[model samples]
Target: MDNKIIAILCGLLTCFHLSTAFATENGSDSFSLGAEGIMAGALPPAGLYFLGYYQNYHANKFIDGPSQFYVDANAVVPRFVWMTNHNIANGQLGWYVAQPLVDLKVKINGLNDSNQGLGDLYLGTMLGWHHQNHNWLAALETVLGTGDYKTPSQTHLVRANIGKNYDTIRPIFAYSYLNSNGIDLSTKISYSWNSKNEATNYKSGEYFAGDYSLGYRIQPKIKVAVEGYYFKQMKDDKDNGKDIDFKGQVLAIGPAIQYANKNWSLEAKFLKETNVKNRPEGHANWLKLVWAF
Candidate 1:
């Protein structure tokens, strides 16, 4: 009986997931939008809810295929998620969207360059589920990236790049568990399927990424946590029938906080990239607000 109880407890406590990865220049991140926890953690009966998400990302250095350079890049993304009271497979269903605005300046090989523009458009569909007692919640989602590639805004002096100019279809799974003793764990996992960039004739490789968090509820309205993410490009990039060889990996970790009540939810998190290869190193900050009726 003791062993069985221990096994059950471990099973209940040790499950997690993450997000997908994509391409970007210095100071730009379409991935790791500070998404943590379970979107399906709790299911609202039947109604409309609003979710507002914001992220500020900056990168100062990076490695591009064996050459390192200095870059000052910043991207701000404002996103919205709409919730519906409808149900599917015992879960709530919804859709969400966003567009990114970017400002980037690079001092590479001794040349100063910069560009600012609206990067890309994003869309997704979601299904969320919550276990009884609010101890566990899970979500499954499909997100699409439009071919935002290089439009006029993407064609700046030096053709400064904000959008990667490719299409992506990624599936995500997220879950969270809170123990009776106030221990909370949440995670998400995703795999990205990528399409070619018609402008550069370059097709970026697909990648996998995830976010994980552990925290303790300190008060009825607040929980403090440590959060992190990891990204890995699974294969080589291709350009015009040739290998571009731009696969890389990234890892980051930091602190996070959440405050919630019956009608509002607010969360903030900061992450610092500590390990990277074949990509830029940077930090990301996120703020999220939600209102429900």
Candidate 2:
């Protein structure tokens, strides 16, 4: 394998689900399931909700330092989420659970690795508010993940790993605003902190992510939007207490469409990475269906 490819893999150890950062083989969200857009703060009627989502990510090439390497990496993540109601902090409280199934493949330089299996279990509780008169909604939530799946060894150059191997805390703030004019805006920001991977004794750096959407509702059941997100690492990953100078970042934007009825909602978005460092630059796509019960 080329040294540049090695650097690419090593440089992205923190890319997995965004635990202390979410962890993944490609990256978080696109691994951890964070950074949602469009009506992120909208509160539904008090009841049970179920969501099914799928994402396909393809990045065939990457740049690291002054070297660029060829890669043909693709990942398919299927996720399911369940949320229900309660009351907390004088606001409606909702608790949710998410399970992710991941199929990842990579071909970098002349080496290849693939893995298909269960990822991590994510759970969270949120307090949500909707002011109908003001057309505003807001939510505060804390997400947590269990690291009980596949983890790469410390000496791996490339491996098929589905889990980050560290417990993570992801706290989030979500807001949205809409008016009679059909204009709408939504944003969500989340920060993650991860515990050390005792098996490898590696500590990924903390990270911050922000997602936004601007849209216009053409009708009560149809909408179009522009969606984008930004991610930045706050510090360097550590190996047994040694800083590794491998912070990473990326930005993406694209268009989206959503259709909703009384009981079901469907959404699709396409994002292209506009800028990146020590990471892959390519296209990511999302398809989601949600139903209220």
Candidate 3:
């Protein structure tokens, strides 16, 4: 019968590309506060929503000592969403939360460094499965500390996403893992679990990341994206005894632009670190702004 109808249409197109890569690995960026889609356009039973953002960072290391530029002023950065849709067990469910409020400053190697504090708080969830044209997603996220002032030392994240929605364009892939513990501020110490000395009690360590995205809408509101990210940092019992080895790696690439309607939305992003290891003043650059309801 025509070769069994072309082998059942090539096995249903390879299960629809593995269910859109597992719905873009579970859709993240912390509920779209980071932008790129996967929050189901603002999930929930369809009620209560909010978002805000602001970010900035600059660096220069043509060959110097330290100093890497920094600036992050956040105001009312918040997000909360919930959505549900299950008709006879078809699929659709999501939840989200986000918070930000920080002010930072640095000059490095030349002196002048400051940190106001309050950043890092997120929670997310998603589940989708409905095929008629396309639909398949799975996601999970976490990063909570409930910041108030000095933050860092609160980490927990898990992700898996896969997406495919063609009509305009939607491509996503993600994999994430993070676990942090190490913070005891007295004076000079930021990130890397507060410069671990033994990390006295908070015992710092953990990081593993991955990201990839492609979204283009242009019309239905507007969308644009290009992203890449990778990070690794995990090795500390105080590094066995410490001869002199910290272990770090980071790579970043970016370009993002978004605009939405139905309520309000606007976003911008730019990241470039190319590649870095051990810490070359940790090259960096960032910019962000978002608002939603």
Off by over 4 Å in 2: 1-35, 65-85, 133-157
lDDT of 2: 0.57
| Model 2 C-alpha lDDT per residue in residues 32-85, reported as the tens digit of each score | 332366676666656666666666766766645323333332333333333345
- The sequence of per-residue lDDT tens digits that candidate 1 reaches over residues 136-181 is 3233333333422333223242334555655666777666666656
Candidate RMSDs in Å, in order, are 8.5, 8.9, 20.8
Alpha-carbon lDDT, every model:
0.55, 0.57, 0.34
Error of 2 at 186 (Å): 0.2
Question: What TM-score does candidate 3 reach?
Answer: 0.24
Clashes of each: 7, 15, 16
TM per prediction: 0.77, 0.81, 0.24
lDDT of 3 by residue, 117-205 (tens): 44446565554443332333444555443343221222311111111111111122222111122111110001212222121122223
Cα lDDT for residue 17, model 2?
23
In model 1, which range of ten residues has the least summed lDDT?
A: 6-15
